[model samples]
Target: MTSPDEPHDVSSGVSSGAPATGAHGLGPHVVGTRVVVRRLVPGETGPTGGPAFTDVLGVAETWWPDLVVRREDGTAVTVPHALIVSGKPVPPRASRLQHVPGGEVQRRVRGLWPGETAALGDWLLQVSPPHEGRVRRRASSVLAYGSPDRPLGEALAAIQDWYAARDRRPELCVAVGSAEETALRAEGWTEPADFAGHAVAVQVGSVARLRRALGASPHTAATGTVATEHGPVAGAAPDVERVRVSVTASGDRIATGLADLRGDWACVHDVRTDAAYRRTGLARRIVAGLLDEVAERGVTTVVLHVLTTNDPALALYAGLGFEEHHTATYLGPPR
Candidate 1:
């Protein structure tokens, strides 16, 4: 679900060429989403009549009343409204996870948290108690992979001991509905902690999309694209090293995008543009450059966490085909 402010662009219902629009109209939101349709009952032969299900999994492209659909196997079938009896969109497919049981993806995101981690069975204790003013929940939370492989009570005891040693408190940074969150609650560690709120989204598209968006960027000339590990970024820590990929369409480093690569996924950290470069499509070019640079490493999925209130960032990402996967909020341990 999108934030109250960020309404998704999916069609609510679709209208295809007659037969005629259904009483409720086929949900346009159904377009782009998978759906199953049952054509008018077999008043005739060959499964055409009598409430039969066309369990065909395909993306609805248009509902000109003639619902055009694209299938996974690169096949397209147009379902005319006349043939429709009933249909509805199904849940979106998840080939990625940054939510509950986000599993491997969540594990990979550990790189972005900037902390020392200790392997405690299947979990990792992020030891970022207090260094400077960065005392917060993320740096001092347990990343639960599977189960600890240790007893629950023992795990809690060990966590408390470790945090006590660091003069900090133990906390879990698991996805809201994840088993780990539930596990922590069962142990009587149920104080709801708040970290800067964030939500993760998934987008499935080819490098072609990236190339197109990049091409449209204001300073997207071939020279605009820059690929390097040490590219200059705005507001970056002077001593912090990053694998920066950016674009300089207006010269003098106007736009940049940075990523933290982990195995197959790249956590896009910052995609920025100079004030004068705003609305000029430089940011898109930067993202394109960033993704194109990382694609060489077989990075297929790009993930990012954005503040729920960042409306502009949310819109920019949505236009790039990203869809909400899940959200995570930091929850502190019991006092």
Candidate 2:
């Protein structure tokens, strides 16, 4: 059975780093203790010809392990318990310098080549093999540096070193302003796109007005409903009783939008109007109402992802003052 603390990886062996050590000492290794795997950092084969694990850490959810670390910079890495080695207590800071799951360091470090060194900060670097260069290139991601203590140049240098180590090139580097971009451009990186700005606006007043607007408008055309004694009625909508709103006579729904508390941003997903009510301003009303609901929650900023080709929807969102913050496009190799 899998332990709750060991991190698991399918392509590699289990992580055997000690758990009890802290930033200053070697961690402990348990022979059969259960552990939740936090992450599988890349490792090198040992001189003796066996797999040598480096920078792996696990924790027991119930107890405070020797060290506690968070993904300080937003990035994602896979973590499973099976990657941990049994029979060892984790040290406080065994893998303090290692990348956190989803952290910018880990995301960018994957692209480093064997002889190259990926610089994460003034003191941190990730070194990998040249044979895995392609894998490392795809692993590059953007990271935000907000610390006043760290200069932009220092951060960029660290990231460059990391990419260099992985035999990959950093495509684009974003910092606070043009100065940072200019600095990177001077270092042989070209600008592929312009920096896009985003706006945040809050809706004001009672949600009733927006809800009423949604019902009064005619965008709910695609919605299907069962015919009842009175008229067409859509099936039960998702449970959203907390916010104040009323369903329209045509079974149109208006309620507080859903929020994804797991991430930093909140989204109002899949707002639609009946097909028969096309172009009558119903969709706008629903969106306006949702904006009001979000504003009432004291959330000034809202974000939603839409396909770039979706012109009409993009126009509507743009009319509401939402500008593109950033964009990602997928490309396949030439046929």
**Candidate whose lDDT is highest:** 1
Error of 2 at 74 (Å): 37
Candidate 2 — which residues are off by over 4 angstroms? 1-140, 144-154, 160-177, 191-222, 225-298, 304-314, 321-335
Worst 10 residues of 1 by lDDT: 1-10
Per-prediction TM-score to the true structure, in the order listed:
0.57, 0.29
lDDT per residue (tens digit) for residues 74-139 in model 2: 111233334433224433332222222222322222222123333344223333232212222222
RMSD of model 1 against the true structure: 8.8
lDDT of 1 at 70: 54
Runs of candidate 1 with Cα error greater than 4 angstroms are 1-101, 111-114, 128-140, 186-242, 247-254, 274-279
Per-candidate clashes come to: 27, 70
Superposition TM-score, candidate 1 onto the true structure = 0.57
36-111, model 1: which lDDT tens digit per residue?
6666434444554445545455556556657766555535577777777677776645543334346455565655
Clashes of 1: 27
